[model samples]
Target: MASPALTPTTPATRDVVLVPPAIAMVWTGAGRPHEIVAVPGVVLGAGETLVAIELATVCGSDVHTVEGHRAAPAPLVLGHEYVGRVIEVADGVRAVDGAHVQVGDRVVWSIMASCRECDRCRRGLPQKCRAVLKYGHERIQTHWELTGGFATHAHLRAGTAIVRVGESLRAEVLAPAACGGATAWAALARADEVADVDGATVLILGAGLIGLSACAMATDRGATVVVADPDPARRALAVRFGAAQVADPRDVRALTAALAATGSPEYDIVLEASGSPRAVQAALEVVGVGGVVVLVGSVFPTEPLPVDPERLVRGLITIRGVHNYAPRDLDAAVRYLRDRGAARPFEELVSARYPLAQIDQALAAASAGRAVRVGVDPRDAHRRC
Candidate 1:
């Protein structure tokens, strides 16, 4: 004899599952393999909400975390560059209600949550917020903070600075704005002090996301932008982005001579977006007296850059190191993209998109320079759906 199905009036015996669906990439140990795991029905915390991730980009930083080079714990959820829709909001979180955020509203949030009362936050530099914690940090325990955008759902805290994207912008296009685009905005803010973009000559090193963005902004600011990169394709892209000139770093001497013929030491500002030490050295060589050199890229296993002290002193050079972006920077990037006509045709920086199940392939494509931006669609059928 079989038991009858429980009716509304009868007592239930089955466990009430509480876990929410999440697609998480987990590393077992150092040099060990990683696996994507699915958790069903994870709980959302008070003053928090669950976001159904629409698109999550694989940033260079994400590669560092996955390779265990960042000293982060294993079996972690990866990804910080993302945009999504709010599915559930905790009680008392009123701002997100009906602002088109029910089940399917376009949105994006910052990577770190800063305590607004902190000294750094008070000073208008929330990136330096002392009490802040990143998404993948080992300290957070709750599913909301632990499982980041690489999953089906991301837990957003009460203080999370969320930006609502317009319906016109494509999720795949706006995804990079969360990190790569924001970083470029921060760099430009610092560069403006010395670059005097209205009429100044500027030299930009590398043609990656940051470099291309700088070129675009500088051109918009009326500066003559010169870009250098070894890759021909990137060099061509830089030219398309409005760079006044593009050259290969290997032919620095010839490029410098040609520029000098037009007018030597023409650059009033040198922006180094390449982490290579050689590029830094070349940047210092090309900048004029009283020029500014902004270091915007990160170099791993920090080593002493071979810089000429005498030249730096004699040239009255100003060297500034730029880190991650602040909230204001993100706002600026969004505004720039919005105002510049979101439909502007540009190269498809995203070369590929892999489902969360194929994270290994995605990571490899990102790290090998095969793709400028690789994305993971966490809600794909093969993911922990």
Candidate 2:
């Protein structure tokens, strides 16, 4: 007889008691088992706040972390893109009162926390702040400091980085803006410096969340956008989201022919979000000699790409890597969503929503590309308990 499948069960505490602790799905190591552990209540310090997580989304970077493609320590908090409510605020937090952020005020936060005294912070590049504490990096050895949104609540050190979500947006859709959407917006902002979008030709490699968002943002900026992806469903969705053209990234000959037929040998700018070495090479081939290539996706193991150094020297192609979003980038993304009513059709991108108990199922679905985005709602499981 075949073995039975293991169904995800509601997390249970010791002694069969139903205590609502922070449940986190953690990876032990490379090729090791993953489990859900219920951690005791996290304590907050002065000028800190505990946010009750409303919704958290699984991202591609999360997959990289799980598969040990990156140097992630075991038993780490996993999520970065999320929306939550302020449950408690510590003493000495005067700028934001209970009125400004009550016990139930919904908000979204940035993944990176920076010290204002850093030179990068002074220059408005908090993403590169020298005293930054990334949620997943194990180097930061502060208790209750490295926790992320994957749990029931995340601890936030007080600063001006958090953005209060307006009533018009939903948590499921707004969760991804903290990372994916913000990254795309920052890449587009940099690409705009070299290519005037009023009537320029732009190409995006990858039709995933960041790629589609790039298409929408470039269209909003008046650029004609072309998208390349292997998935037909994503390509169709890109068209609906405002892509003028779609092609397959693997078929370089076809892509070249298509571009040639359009009377342009190269696009003014190429946005690479696929993180594939081939995609990066293709972006170099597709962009004009003087065009720019903005890399927004994460590349693991620091692999080298098959690029001709001679071509790079002669092409003068401006290649830039965008790490994370600045505070101003987040504000700009919020404004774009509000002004253009861009998120009205965001429901289509949300492929599934699972209770926190089904976190394993959610991660599986995301890994299989079964959805554009998968959300975890903690309230559902909390209610059952």
Q: Write the per-residue lDDT of candidate 2 for residues 1-385, one digit (tens) a residue.
A: 1111101121212111125666655556656554566655644554556778888898877777776667776667777888887777664443222335556667777777766565677887878776565654432233453267666777665443677776777786688888888888899988878777666788888988888877888887788788889998888888887877788889987677656655655788889998888888888887888789898764565578777778767888788889888876776766676676353365567779888777666777888896888887877655532
- Models 1 onward score TM values of 0.85, 0.85
- Please give the distance, in angstroms, between residue 202's alpha carbon in candidate 2 and its true position after superposition: 0.9
The numbered model that scores best in lDDT is: 2
Lowest summed-lDDT stretch of 10 residues in model 2? 1-10
Error of 1 at 41 (Å): 3.6
User: lDDT per model, in order?
Assistant: 0.70, 0.71
lDDT of 2 at 126: 79
Candidate 1 is scored at a TM of 0.85
Off by over 4 Å in 2: 1-22, 30-40, 90-103, 136-146, 257-265, 341-344, 383-385
